[model samples]
Target: MKKIGYLILIICFLSCESETIETTTVNEELTAQQKTVTTNKNEAVVIRFIAGLSEAEKSVLRTHYGVTAYEKCSCGDENLESWNLEAIHEGATIEERVSSMEEEPEMEGADFNFDIQIASQVPTDVISGPIHYQNVLPKIRSQKASVTVGVLDTGIDPTYFRFQQPFLHNTVLDEETCGNDFFGWNFIENNNMPIDDNGHGTIVSYMIYEQLVNTATDFQILPAKAFDTDGKSTLFRIGCGLSYLIKKEVNIINMSFGWTTTSSAIIGSYIKEAEHNILMVTSAGNTGENNDEIAHFPSSYPARNILAVTAVDGEIPPTLVPILSNFGPISVDVAVHGIGLPFYTTAETAPTSVTGSSYASAKAAGFAASKYQEGTAMAVFYHKILLDKIQSSTLLQIKYASYLDL
Candidate 1:
């Protein structure tokens, strides 16, 4: 099969809430054009090809089209070779491009590339009140390594004291093909150390750790750094991250980041493959737009065990509409505290304040982890209970069948 290039269109804007002051940071670098994959005029945007290509077919691809085959990365996921590829060829259109190759004597009816897509940009911040998830923990059945939660973001701050709690096991994954990482793989530097340079991942991981780790000692947190120090990543990296977690048999995955457009087919396939095995919790984005109108990936990806969470402030008749959060009575699954909440950043030991849907999603994932059971994690059942346990005062009464609607 011909591999197609997948790009991730990421847009990030962050805000923090503190008792004394508030801060906002807008990242203008992430956009559609900026995020698109670039190839020379003579190169073709291909990801991976079907295995067992005859010698003749290989010659046609290399000599005739100047296409070069190479491994996607050292992440060690077999799907990486099947889902991501790059080559050099000229084609007027995607269909036409394939037709020309098929015209060859041995190439007739041969499949080549799979469609690719850009990734969504997901965010964080917090507001405090009566603790969420407190009541739900006792109801969950806990066991050692009963559930593993994957945190895919910039990276985690392993040195954080809060994360050092004996009950909390922030287990580091071994990227054997590459080496051993005490924390997680840094796809940016292709290194074992996935320490957070940007503060986004730290906040995302911290929020979840604080909420669930101590409550559920048997629950494990696996950090998979998909984004770089600048808070940017491609759909390929995101896919690899998911694949790694899936191999680890993680029960829940927290994607505190998002993209506004449809997700790439390759990543979608991975999500589909893990549909029954994992539950994905993604942020609704910080755009404040309606996701029902303009879909967000992983969140909008119609699949099983995927929950899209929006932000809500801690107020009487709680404000489900965060000034910087995206919502879709139809697209989002729930709303939680995402206003001015105190948390830690990569650069600081003391707690700082932040606000966004990313934080809300983390909170939701943490809650899900608390309730998750390896063999009996019924998506619908847990979803119902989650909605039931959510602070009634903090939830919005929407028309859609959403957690907030409860």
Candidate 2:
């Protein structure tokens, strides 16, 4: 089958208490383009292929296209390549980039095509009803655990009011900045600290901290920037960031970003680290596709007992699942509130509402970390308390229907 390229389009969130965030659409077509430009003798230039290429084509691409990195499809088959330029030329001719070969790659395994599905809406009237917090927070707060939760995403704003305390550490910068102090390290720039070009990371950090504050629980929040403001980062940078966390042996790791394919080396290293008993929670992705068809990677990688969470909109009655959330047996471990949730902003000035599986993954991370202090494996803790609640609730519903039939 033809390899598919996935793109994510995000809509901004309004005020923290806002009921719903608007949705946006992504382009459906995939095409390749090339441009020729004048080059200065001292300036270096790079050519990137907008689509996948073959190994022989890559060799030809290197000779003609001058790109630093070629974009490769993560579907196990290598089909695309990009080129970087070392020098610019005014006389350089831009050629149309395309694959001469037309044969489609073979699809192995199951012919599963997973699409994003919207679940029932959550009831807003019972917003004050008994939530998981009512049952778990009290026990956790009383213990005053020193558990640390790591957020791996866009860099956070340290000065955000919700994370102003000393408990918040920016692992990317190897420095501790308060909620009122915002500093970040940009892996793209090879900086010492993180900076929030995109507000998403800061928002996610705020959500986790807010949960801790609301629960009166004492836990540390470690901010790790895996993506930059442009919503992009190199696979090497991500691998390095995770390596840092593994070295620290933190209690929980929250990852909200993923691509179509994963690096086996990087994933294997993480699995080895997980063997040390650290818990990982990831976003199932917002592709709005079934897990079998286009599930996000890293979250979809074959790992034992990882928590892959889907997003749900809380503004709608009955807490319906977010339409963009990718789901399948292999993709989603559970669902959590992602939209219309209150969280802190990059300015740390006030709280705001934001939507995305990023927040859902954060919530899961915070919840799991809180329970870890109770001496439970992160996966086991969530499975026993949280997953059990969901499974049992479903079972109860089925039993009630059978009883009525009898």
Please provide TM-scores, in order, for all candidate models, with all chains considered together. 0.68, 0.55
Q: What's the C-alpha lDDT at position 101 in model 1?
A: 46
RMSD of each: 11.8, 15.6
Output the worst ten-in-a-row residue range by lDDT, candidate 1: 4-13
**Model 1 stretches with alpha carbons more than 4 Å out:** 1-71, 81-144, 166-183, 345-350, 384-406
Deviation in angstroms for 323 in model 2? 3.8
List model 2 lDDT by residue over 1-406, tens digit each: 0011000100111122233212111111211111111111222212222234545655664555344444332211222212334343234433222121111122111111111111211111101111221121112121223677777666654543445455554232323222121122344444434444455566666667766766676687655565654455544455545655654556777777766542233344454546546677777676565655554656776665467776655532213343565566545667676766654232323334555666787777766665565456645665553533343232121111110000
Best by lDDT: 1
* RMSD after Cα superposition, model 1: 11.8
> For model 2, what is the C-alpha lDDT against the true structure?
0.46
